[model samples]
Each structure stands twice: as C-alpha cells, then as structure tokens.
Target chain A: MTALPMEAEILTRREESPGLFTLHLRLTDSAAQQAYRFRPGQFNMLYLYGVGEVPISIVSDPREARHIGHTIRAVGRVTRGLERLRPGDRLGLRGPFGNGWPLGDCEQRDVIVVTGGLGCAPVTGAVQYLMRRRERFGHVNIVQGVKHADDLLWREQYECWDRMPDTTVLIAADEAGPLWPWHVGRVTDLFDRLRFDPAQAIVLCCGPEGMMLAVAEQLQERGIAAERIWLSLERNMQCGIGLCGHCQLGPKFVCRDGPVFSWREIAPLLRVRGR
Target chain B: MATDCTLVAELRFLAAADRQRLIEALREAGYAVHGPRVQEGVIRYAPVERIEDLPRGWRDIQEPGRYRLRQTDENRLFAWAAPAASLKPLVFPPREILFHARRDADGRLRFEAADGAAPKLAVLGVRACDLAGLYLQDRHFLQGAHPDEAYRRRRRKLFLVAVHCAHPADTCFCAATGDGPVARYGFDLAISELEEGWLLEARSHAGQEILDALPTRAAGETQRKAAEAAFRQAAAAQRRRLPGGDLPARLGGRLDAELWQAVGRRCLACGNCTAVCPSCFCHAHVEETPLTGARTTRLRQWDSCFTAGHSLLHGRPVREDTASRYRQWLTHKLSGWHEQYGRSGCSGCGRCITWCPEGIDITAEAAAIAGEEA
Candidate 1:
C-alpha cells in the first residue's frame, strides 16, 4: 500500500539546544502504531497540518513501540513550523522509511559511532540500541564534534552512555568555553587518543558531507576496510519512499537504496561535486 | 519460436474506415479510449469518440526548440511520431490528490486515503518510444516492493495500442535507444500504418480477443513486408545516436567535464525539458488548505531537477547552479539510472529536446562528453 501520513499526537516535547528540540509522538491510530515498526537509522516524514512535511530521523530506541521520538533542528520553514508543536498537538507521520543502519552487519565487530553537529540525531537510536545489547558487539565508541561546546544537543545522554561499562565516548568542540570539559579540537583530531583493532571495527559516521568524508578518510588511514565503514548521508529527501527523486546521489536514492550506505559503495560518487 | 510464428500468423489488417469500428469495439468492451487530437496549434492526448479525433494527415515537424503541425497529403492516422505530450500523463498525472485530512467537531483529526478506482482506459496511438517509457514507469511504480497504489489502480485495466513510427521526427532518436521505430513488445496490440491499411499484430491474449472482434482480415505477406520496410526506413532516418558501449560508465566518469558548463550557460532553469520528458518522474507535494483552514488536501505535482527547491537541504540547495542541475539531470538519465533502475532512464522520445526553449539537446551534450577522454 502507498504510504499515508497517520495522525499522531505529540506526547512530550524537549528543547535540546537553541532552535533544536525533540518531539515524542504517540500514534492516535492503534493500527498505525502496530504497523509502524522502525529500525535505528530509519526516518519518518512528519507532516505539520496546514504547513508541510519534513523528513526527520527517528531518534528514539527501536524497542519503544508505543511512542516514537524525533529530534529536529529548526533549519527550514517546515522545521521552524514544527518548533511551535506542543504536547497534545496533532501532526501527521508517514514512515519508518529508508534503509537503516546495518546493526546486524556489525555482529561481533567493534562499533565506532562518529558524528558532527546535529548529524548525531540519526545515529543516536543506534547508539542507544547498542548500549542496551552491549554484549552483542566487541567495543562501542561514540566520537562527536561540534563547532562550539553549546552546540552539542544531547550532552546528558552522552554523559550517561559514557559511564556504561565497555563503552567509550569522545567529544570535540572547536571553540570550547570554560564550561567545556572534553577535548577541544576537530573530530579527526580525537582519533589519536582512541585505540581499537581496526580489522575488527565497523565505523558508523554521520555529519555534513565534508566532515563525513574527512572522518571516513581518517578511519581508512587507521586500517579499517572501506566496506566496514558505514555513513548516513543526507540529501533533499521528500516522499521518503524514493518516489519524489529529490534525494538521488549518483545511482542511489538516499530514501530507498540508502540513507545508510557502506563507505566503499559511495566513495566514488562522493568525489563528484553537486551530486 | 512456435508462439512467435503463430503470433505473426494471427496478424490482421484494418481499413481506414474500420478504424472507427475498432474504437467502437473498445468502447463497447468498457474502455474510455484516448488518442491525440489537434488542440489549438498543438496535438494533445484527449478523449476520442470517433476516428476524426485523431490527428489525421496532420504530421508534426519537430526539431530542437521547434514543433509545428502541417497538413500532409498522406491520409494515414499514424503519420507522425509522438506529439509534445506522451503517455506519461495517462498513468502519472501532473497533479493528483494523495489524501485529505480534516479535524472533526470533537477535535479528533481524521485522514482518508485517496480513492484509487480509475476508469478503464484504452490509450490509442502510443508510439514505440512512449510505450517503452510507459514500461519504465511501470518498473518504477508497479514492479517495486511498495507499488504506488494510485498508479497501480489506474493502470490495472489499462490497454495499450502502440503505433509504429512511420515518419521519424528531427528531435527523435528512439532508434539509437533501441526503443522505437518499431515496438517489439510491451503493448497489447502493435499497429504499423502502411500506405494501404493498418497492419495490426496481437501481442497478448487480450489484444488477440480485440482483433478477433474488430473488422479485420488476414494481413497479406506484402503488407507485412511493407510494414517492416517502413519501420526500417524510420530507423535509418534518425540523425542522432547515443554513444554505444557502457554509456552509464562513460557519462558517470565525466561529472567534472566542462561540457556541462557550456550547456548550463544557455539553460534558463525553467524545467521545460523535465516537464515534457516522457520518463522524468520527479514530483513535489503541495498541501491545499481551504479558507476555513479546518481541512487540508495533500497533492503531488510534477517537479523538475532544474528547480532550486528540488535539491534544497536545510535552506541550502545542493545543486545551486544551473550547470550542476543540468549535469545532475543528464547524468541521472544516462548514467546513474542504469545502476538505480537497472536500465537507462531516457527512452529517446526527444520531447525534452523539442519542448526546451533553450534548445539544450541532451544527445549533443552527451556526445560531447563521450567524445572527451576525461
């Protein structure tokens, strides 16, 4: 059946940072809720009634079936409109679309999560999933980079995950203030402080294209095979089912073929400008 | 081989007057027949009740950025190739309401999916290239895991009557794409317009049934031979050809080529080429709110890669410049589409060429890239 936006009521709203917030929605339709199972990196098309729809990554753990969570930054008209949403407010949702992060592909391999700025939203669910089932993976590492210390969205969540056994969290802010207690540099700069078996590690990266490219290159230099490195890419995605054709990058429809792809598959196309 | 022989043996011929009988037969069989008719100065696909609705003796002359209909002495119905409009709009409409949402008096919001019950349609006079384009569209909308219910519903009982191109247009290069001049398959019935009468070949059981009921006679060997010869002539008349051998790789490797910059300079970013393209399927969603603002209907409208909004990411357009947008369009059609859809996107109908106001010939641009080594 063709995807249609089902009515969902905002159960809770949280302001993560300046102009960045997360909305927890409970599907008003019981049938829609039962059918709306999603993987870690899959996204939902949130339709703001009378405004428009925007593709937002599902930021909550996939295990939580009752309520779905979406972290959004007010970057465009639709996102800014979403900022006005309050608890009990009604909106529309159509998704759990796009290929999610290949958690199964990690298996017993070491998992390295790398993100910059608000790019962490897509990978947060996967990180939480890994933390819940920590025994399934070898080592868990979350490496993040933001322009300023205040730009970090989920500081408390990072702190919570950092204290978990066998999990490593590394943060880097380019312009750190007195309140900042993490490493003060670019994300690539934090690679020198971390130690892991590159052969047994699978890297998951998400950020601006340039940042992801740099991170992938750094990971490749550390002897991680290109096939083991996965990156969540972003394009102008509409109709998250791949029909709209906006999120096309080379041969891949980011909505269908992937928002999550192995670095080896996208490496050649990444070199091309304006793809 | 046996089936092929039997299929050819079942070929029938219909005189020009009996064409009207065929339309009536289709109508009696519960099909709303649609064909090309000269509306204003251009030929557009519209509902047809009689043979007079077809653009008879009115052949179109099409070149890059040029389309003119002129009266020819030939009394044949399928005298010309495809008009500016192709078979796209029949399956994928320009604008379609996906669904409607409304808030009730009790403050409960209700949603209704768009009704997908479409009228039984028989699209007549579809050219070989247009037929190929329709097949590609089917692959996208119906063959996928999540088939488009609306398109699938509309296409469920649809009938295709493919007309072989007897006269190739200047902009047309379907011969090069191996999709036109003659349609090998993917049509219910394939008609070849010969000088004497129409040589109709049934490609499917439904077509065979239709042929059995229509006013028709066995096609003579001479008529069949003449039809083949006409198709050959049409193919031989094509002046443009896409580069052979791994076209996807050839075009994909030239993303940074300077040829795109040259073509982009002339592009107005008006999206005319995409609008007229038989295979381009990009679309935008529009939310229609009434004056009361209590109800909203979401509509999907045809969109183009040329628009800045099409590639917008966080208030920034990915392909901001015309050069990049043009490159994305051509490369996706010729190169990336092969990997994405397991086939080339362009059916070589050349509607994009004739309809483009800037006359940006895709074939010319592709050839330039193919000619370059790097």
Candidate 2:
C-alpha cells in the first residue's frame, strides 16, 4: 500500500551469476528501511529513468536490509538499461510490492525449493529466509537446473547450502561440460532422486513455465497436494499495482495479489498463464 | 418557493458575444480555454480565440452503417462528441517521454521521469460517453497499482466544462453502458444548448463564479423542462443496446464461442477501432539513449492490443493471427475489463463500431455472440 515514486540511483552493480547480475543499491530516501518490511517473494519496479520501468523480484533476503539486491537478467529495454548501469549510477525504483512467498506456512514444514535459470530470483528471496532460520524445519532441499554449467546462478550460496548440515542441494543442466559434476538432463530428473515425503513438504518452485508445469505434475504424481506447491509467475507487470490491466493472470494482480501463488490457486488460469 | 422547478431557471446563459469574453476571462484566470471549433469539415477540440471560431452550424451524423460531418442550423458549440477521436491523447498523450538516462563523462548513470507541462485546460463540451472513457482509462492508467505520473499530472490540472448531448448518433450507445449522452460527474459545469443561447448550469464553485461573471439570466420553468426533455430524448434515441447490463458477465462464460472465429475472417487488424475507442489506453515504453549520451529517454507511445508487436515476447508474438488478437480486443472490452477493473471498459461511443476499415461492427458482433449463446 506504500506508494512512493521510483528513485533512480545505482549504488553498486556487478555480474554474479550466468545472465544474472546483482545490483547493490543505496536508494533515494529510506528504500533500505522499507525493504525489511518487504516479505520474501515480493517484487519492485526498476525504472531506468528515461527508459521506463520493469518489475523485478527482490533476490536478496529481506532480513539483510542494509541495501537491496536484485538478481536481474537483461531482458527488455528497461532491464537492459538497468543492466548497463554502473556503480554510483542512479535508477528509478518503486515498491517492494506484491504478495511474496508465504514464510509463515513453511515454518514447521519440510522445505523443498526448486528453481531454474533466472526464475531463481524470487525463490532466492525465500531461500535466504529459510537459510537464516535453518533450524526450524526438517529435510530442507534445493533442486536447480540451467541450460549449461555457466547458466547456474548463486555458486557461492549453493556451495554454502550444500555444506549445511540438514540441507541437500542437487543441481542439473541440459548439457554439461567438464565443470559440472551433477546429473545431466532436465530439472524433472532430479525429482526422482529425492527421498522426502511430499505430504510433509512445502514446495516452492520457480522457472520456465513449461518446466514448472511438468514439475508440478511430477509432484502431483508423487502424491503432493496442490496446496503444498507454490509458484512464482512470470507475466507482464506494467503498473505493479492493480491498475494498468497489463499484469492480469485471470483476476489476480501479479503485482498486488502475488508474484508468488500456490499451484492450486492458479490451476484454473494456467491455460492462459505463461503469456 | 414554487419548488423552483426552476431547475436552474435563474442560471445564466452565455451570449454569443460572451464566448469571446469568456475565453479572455479564462486566459486571465489562468485556464487554457479549449472548445470545439471547425478546422476543415469537422468540429475539433482546440483553443477558442473568438466566438465565431467555436463550431457553429455543425453536427456529426454517426451510425453503424455510416459516420460523417454534416451542417446543422444550431450554433451550439457542444453539439457533437469526439469526432472519431477521444480526449485520451491530450492527457496521456499519443507519445510522451517518460524518463531519460544519461551516461556522464565519467560513466555514471542517472534516470529522471518526465513530469511534462501542465496546461490548466478548460475542456469544453465533453460528452458522457468520453467521460466514461476517461474514467475507464483512468482505471487502466491512474487508478490501478502505480500512478502514471504524466497522466496524473495532466488529468489533475484539467478544468472540465461539459456539454450535454442534445441528440444521439446512430453509432452512439452511451445509454447501454450507463454512460448516457448527458454529461455527468467530474464536470465543473454542464452546458445545455437551447433555441436562444444555452442553459448553463454550474455544479462546482469555479463554474458558479464563471457563470456569475458572464452575461446572466433568470428563467421560467419552460426552459428547464425543455433542457431535461432534450437530454432524455437524446439518451432514448441511442440505438445500440447490450441486450442488458449482464452482457459483460454473460460474455465471460463464452470466451471460446464460435462467433470469434466467425468475425475473424473479416478483421483487417488496422487498429482503427482501438484508436477511435474512448477507453483503450494501452501504451509501451522504450528507452532511447543516443550514442553521444546527450540524452537517453524512455518514450511512452500509444500501443494497441490489436497490434502483433504489443504482445511480442522472446521474438514471438502471442496473438500472431488476427483471430486471437481481435478476440483479445473484444473480450477485453466486453469481459476482461470488468474482471480486472470491476467495470466495462467500453463507453459505447460506437467509434469502434463505425471506424473499422472492414466495418467490423462490435454491436453486431456482441449480438452474434449472445444470439448463438442462447
């Protein structure tokens, strides 16, 4: 409900993952402070001032609120404009909007966060939250896939997760060079290797729409209920509010209603979802 | 005390000479007085410098079968609406610079949104249909999630002076959408043209003062009845009806009805329908930064959903064929708009129904969809 005009500033910028770059920003006014009140799975509109704005999910954890980090890919004009920004540059920003990942539901449940490509951005927010409260849940698992070894993001973070006592990190790629030691195939291949019971897991998945649909079906086949699997949708977010009529996936505003929703809540909308 | 059925009988009427005086007064009052004046053959919205300049002896003949500019003996400036154009571009603008990015000599970047200029426009003779269009577009632009700053700036600065329609064009269906031919809310004043001058009524404080300052009048009940009857008859004459108010909700259940493919064969996809509509407010923003770093600006251009490029992604347009695009357009107008904004996006101005290159009429289309559904 906080409606502030987007501030244009680039506090710091660097490429972190394949096709994914991170910008650590010192925003106009109290962007850092307001970011904490942001829930995981929320999004913000990044404006390149003269270029216009594009909605991006906040990749960094809300608990680490000194600055905001967005793991963005160069997609359209405005994002490409954001990617071109260097350290100390200024870019416009609005929100911390959208109903993000439901952290409260995952508190006592076994967690499985599956992600692919740059779809990892919104899930990254939830992943950070889970990492901070590591002791609260049992059987924490992360399964990731990308086009190539270079396409995988968050190398250091995944390495750290791999080393965590109760956490299991499994990654796959379509084709592998000598650098990849993990499995070779699609993300769905990793689902068969998991030993956890789906009834006890709160599954959070983000990635290509086709991949997510297939994974959701796999989870269903493994007897996982629709309510347990959450998805971060990729749709047009022109206004990042309930207006503009651009970001409608059925009746839901991906900006205000959700950038994150249960697979169940959106089953009726999927026929027209991805576009 | 005679119940004053005087329906603003004591209200002032502007003399033919007073329009010139009013424009000068508005200029003095810091408002840009814009009214309908004949340029070529049509009466268009523009600045009025003289009383004679405002469209006199002109009327617009609109129909599903036809639309044209015709001459009438009436000298009322508010005689017709929106000749094939809505007041959308004047506020949101057809093309606007939304932001700019410039890389300085040291390679530092900066972004700035264009606030644009605010002209305190006194928009004269806006009809109820276009006002509804403005409100619906506001849902698309200003009322949704984030505010469209440039749109908000121009919209907030406007001083509306509306004129009630004394008649309805065959193409006009304002009655069906509840946006009657009579000018309604968000107007500072409403002007009803009469045999002599006009029945000028003020709803806001600015309107009262403007009328108070202009050449004045006091009237009997007869003139007031005439004005009310004129509005009612004009509203009644609207030929296009959406079966009933449930047209939108009913159409929601028929998304894949064969009527879409039925109409698809004739659509040219020229997008003249969207351009002429009062409520279509889609736009796209592109960043343009020159190689010299002189300026990198984000330009917001009027975009139509009918265009293949509007829905393009990953080098593929979503609605490549005309059928899907036309379906999105009509369904959005008749259904998707209500689902999102809680109201129909169409004002039933019939601009889209008339201006099609192939004459793809929407009223006939809706009737077909409903007829087949039944």
Give fnat, all candidates: 0.69, 0.20
Q: Go through the candidates in order and give each one's DockQ.
A: 0.72, 0.29
How does candidate 2 fare on TM-score?
0.85
Q: Write the per-residue lDDT of candidate 1 for residues B243-357, one digit (tens) a residue.
A: 7888888887788888788888999999998888878889998889999988889899999999999999878899989999999999988987787677899988998889888
Docking quality band of candidate 2, CAPRI definitions: acceptable
Give the fraction of native contacts in model 2.
0.20
lDDT of 1 by residue, A106-174 (tens): 879888999999899999999988988889988788999999988987788899998988888999999
For model 2, residues A173-247, the per-residue Cα lDDT tens digits are 998898688988888888877757777788899988788888887887888888888988766656567654455
lDDT of 2 by residue, B57-117 (tens): 7778766545678778876666675566777867877777765666567644555556567
Model 2: CA > 4 A from native: A1-39, A44-55, A72-97, A147-150, A154-201, A217-228, A237-246, A251-253, A273-275, B1-25, B64-66, B112-117, B243-245, B370-374
Give the residue spans of candidate 1 off by over 4 A. B1-7, B372-374
| Deviation from native of the Cα of residue B124 in model 1, angstroms | 1.5
